[model samples]
Target: MGQPVLLSLLVLLAVAQGVVLAYWAIRDRRFRSAHRAARHLHSADTHAGRLALVGEIAGSIAHEISQPLSAILTNADAAENLLGEPDPPLDEIRRMLADIRRDDLRANDIVRHLHSLLKRRELQTTMLDLNEVAATALSLIQPVARKRLVTVRSCLDPMLPPVRGDAIHLEQVLLNLMMNAMDAMASNTANGAAERILDVTTDRYDKYSAAITVTDTGPGIAAAYRPRIFDSFFSTKQEGMGLGLAIARTIVHAHGGKIWQEGTSAGGAAFKFTIPLQAA
Candidate 1:
């Protein structure tokens, strides 16, 4: 009887020890993962990286701004030339003045977007209309899309309830995603793809949340790269810093949202993100 009791006790003790070892191993793995994540976030949120991103689209923005300025100059010249005429053509000059003012406002809107994007401030949360936010982001991306020969379209839901989020950060998310889609399509277009189109759609996900999706008619992500698409420092592009999707994920998560890639039915790529609606 004593020998049997001793054998049972030894077996129980060994099992307890095994369980303790497994728990510690799991904790250690979690801690290491968290540490690595912190490091990646720190590295990705640098001023230089932001500036580099801005630089990537700076030419397109400059062209956009210059178009309005040139239009204003042409209108101004016409107004001046009319003022020197015998009759002065008051009605014609008035129309030219209106055109000049409209052009100025257009340029101002672009600059405002730049100012908001370039402003270095803490994340601010407020009630935001997702449609307005989407419109602003699409406006900024339109110039680059046009230049790249990509047809950009949006189907924003007018009834999307307000979501509490940081406008600048959310816009950053949209810009990053759109620009990424453009980059992906650029290479595919170079490879003899017939047409490149980007579609932005927003809708109410459910009673508690709203969703936005950006889809591109480009070669979809490879099977091997799908899993790590949002992982920091894991990029398919040779020169990519591999932080855009990661940063976007962090921002979306911070705003009580989830971001993920929704594989397209055909041979394209689509990404969708959802944010909870603001509490009444």
Candidate 2:
């Protein structure tokens, strides 16, 4: 009887030891997995940051170069006009020279804007007119829209309150969204002859947020793909690398704002983003 009791006690001790070992193994595995996941996330975020930096640099270079190129074109046009006439008109030549100067200044302003965007600096938060940002973005994208024969419309609330944000980044976000909308419509070129339209609007929300929406008259996103539309590498276009919306969302979120998509009343797609208004 004593031997049997000792044997039973030993068996119980062995089982308890096994349980403790199993628990430790499971806990260690979970820790390692979590650690690896965190590292991967950090690496992905770093990669995105690097890509954004490169984009800003390239954009600035283009903007700076474009200014000089624009001035050259204007001068060429002016010279052509002077040569076309039987006798060159002094007043017309003077007007053309004035236009060249004006365009050069315009180009200078573009370079300044690009420089501000590419500068590695902290966010200079200030009260910003959302309408001005919207207009800036629209102006930048207007040429692209015209090339595609797309009609661009704007409905801005003139009395809207100001929101706090980095103007450059916010403008970039809006530009990306508008470009994506254009691309979405471009993909359906084979379906039929369709007129493309992009409607942009700014409104004051009752929830104390300022909203900007970009709506496209394109084939709406499928139901199954809606939830994952913002995911990295998820794209509907055959040639798309799918970083636009993801980057836009990141920028918006960094500004303490939100971005989302919905089906528009125009029977197309609409993407709306919001920034909180500065407190009075």
lDDT of each: 0.86, 0.77
Task: List TM-scores for all candidates, in order.
Answer: 0.82, 0.68
> What lDDT tens digits, residue by residue, belong to model 1 across residues 7-94?
9999999999999999999999999999888755544583344555577888999999999899999999989999999889999899
lDDT for 106 in candidate 2 is 69
Q: For model 2, give the 10-residue run with minimal summed lDDT.
A: 42-51
In candidate 2 the C-alpha lDDT for residue 8 amounts to 97
Q: Mark the 10 consecutive residues where model 1 has the least summed lDDT.
A: 42-51
- Give per-residue lDDT, candidate 1, residue 154: 98
Superposed on all Cα atoms, model 2 deviates from the true structure by an RMSD in Å of 9.3
The lDDT of model 2 is: 0.77
Model 1 error, position 278 (Å): 0.9
Number of the top-ranking candidate, with lDDT as the measure = 1
Q: Write the residue-wise lDDT of candidate 2 on 1-280 in tens digits.
A: 6999999999999999999999999999999999888656644553454346436345544654586677769786877879799999878777777777777776776666656655554445688999999997787677567666778999999999999987866777787788778887885563465558899999986667899999998888889999988888788888777776776787678678899999976567999999889873
In order of listing, the candidates' clash counts read: 0, 0
In the predicted model 1, the residue pairs found to clash are none
